[model samples]
Target: MDGVLVDSETYWHRFEDEWVFAAAIEGGDPAHEEVTGMPYYEIYDYLDREYGTTVTKDEFVAAYQDRAESLYGEDVRLTEGIPALFDSLRAEGRPLAIVSSAPQSWIAIVRERFDLGPLDLVLSAEDIDEPGKPEPHIYERAAAELGAEPADCVVIEDSLNGIEAAVRAGAYTVAFRTTHNAELDLSRAEVVADGPEGLRRVFLGSE
Candidate 1:
């Protein structure tokens, strides 16, 4: 939900640059894409495995939680036309869900702030036992919970990891381009959408 449903990625990138990459990881500079779409705990684990973490797991998780409270509560804005898009999809009998690496609490903030739904499902990476994004498990679980096959789902994502996960789950993934990911490689997705309007066209069968 970070980049797709809400524009929280730029804030997260700022946090990562100011703290995570600069101070949390030891000696190696990690790219933002390397961990952006993974769960916070998984991100710490990945960093520890690749570059060694300077902080304890609890400390890292706490930092993220603290930042998220304000980020989602006040800083983030819903994607343009998202409410209308959801309404359009609902009108067509589409089952809407938010499948994200974010925990339920964070997703809750966005949903409540935007009055996002009456959704079919809201699955977080923390809700599943399997690994998070860049892996297929999360999206696979979302499809299943919605009583649909992966091939029948249309996944919208803005991160490389998210795109990879959706693609691996056999869904027709649409890479939602944001200010932060425009230059990143998103070709693995079935379609690349410039913004909310692009997404409306893709989902509503419009040009």
Candidate 2:
């Protein structure tokens, strides 16, 4: 529900730039391009590995939580045409969901802040025992929760990892452009849209 359904990735980059990565020494923070579509724990793992961190993984996670709550609480906004997009999907009886790398709580926060529409399912990377996105578990597990196999569902993904996961799950994926992940190839996805507006046609199979 973040970069896909809301224009929150930029602000999230702010959090990464300011807090989660601020205390680290120079060159320690993740570059914008490095983290697009990556899972939260992976974010922590990358920082821990690259930064020469004395901080425990748990502490880093905690710090990120504190800063994220403060950051996204104020700035997140719904993606353009989301209400129209979901309304159209609902009319078609499509089962829509959010499968994310963020914690369940972060997902909830975004939903409340954006007043997200009804969703058939929502799953977090932490909920599944298998690996995160690009590994097929997060999206595949969400598909299972919908009582549909992965091929039956279509995914709206904005990150490379999410696209890989969706493709591996046998689901159609639509990629959204963002500052970080733009050049990442999404040719394997069923479609790639410049933004959410391009997704309307995919939902209707019009283009």
Candidate 3:
């Protein structure tokens, strides 16, 4: 949802740099690479455990919640060509779903904002008891909900954790290249898409 469906990573990274790193943690640099795909509260936990944050957990969480209202409400835009891709896939009788680590509330914002309806399924990390991304449970759950085998699914993901989770779930994963994770290793994915155009080609069978 963050990077794959909506361009929310830029806002997230900016918030991380300004609030999480500058005001919360005292460090040389916040290892965003280490926590990019982590759940929000877990990000604070990670920072506190590794670098010691100046703010309390509640404060950190509150700040993020406040920012998220604006970020998802007004700041982010759906990835280019995604609506067309969705239409194309739907036309082919594909059971499309959004399997994301984002909370249901955040996902709802995107869904409602973009009128992304007729979704076969919408699975969030919060819906499951198991740990989020880099863990296969969520992806497995999504595939199950869609009445499909994991191996038969093609999951498009933009984060290392997302890619790992999809791959571990036995799905054919397509790693999406975005500014947020341009340098991250995506070798675990079955294929790598340079951008939205590349992503369209991947699904349209042109890549």
**CA lDDT, every prediction?**
0.93, 0.75, 0.87
The runs of at least 3 residues in candidate 3 whose Cα sits more than 4 Å from the true structure, single-residue gaps closed, are none
124-185 in candidate 1: lDDT tens per residue? Answer: 99999999999999989999998899999999999989999999999999999979897898
lDDT of 2 by residue, 32-63 (tens): 65665677667666666676655677787777
What tens digits encode model 3's per-residue C-alpha lDDT throughout 1-207?
Answer: 789889898888888887788889977586666777777877778889999989999999899889988899999988888888999999999999988877889889889999898899999888989888788999899989988999999999888778888999999999999888888888899999999988988989763
Candidate 1 collision pairs = none
Global CA lDDT of candidate 2, please? 0.75
Instruction: Provide the global lDDT of candidate 1 against the true structure.
Output: 0.93
Best by lDDT: 1
Task: Name model 1 segments beyond 4 Å from true.
Answer: none
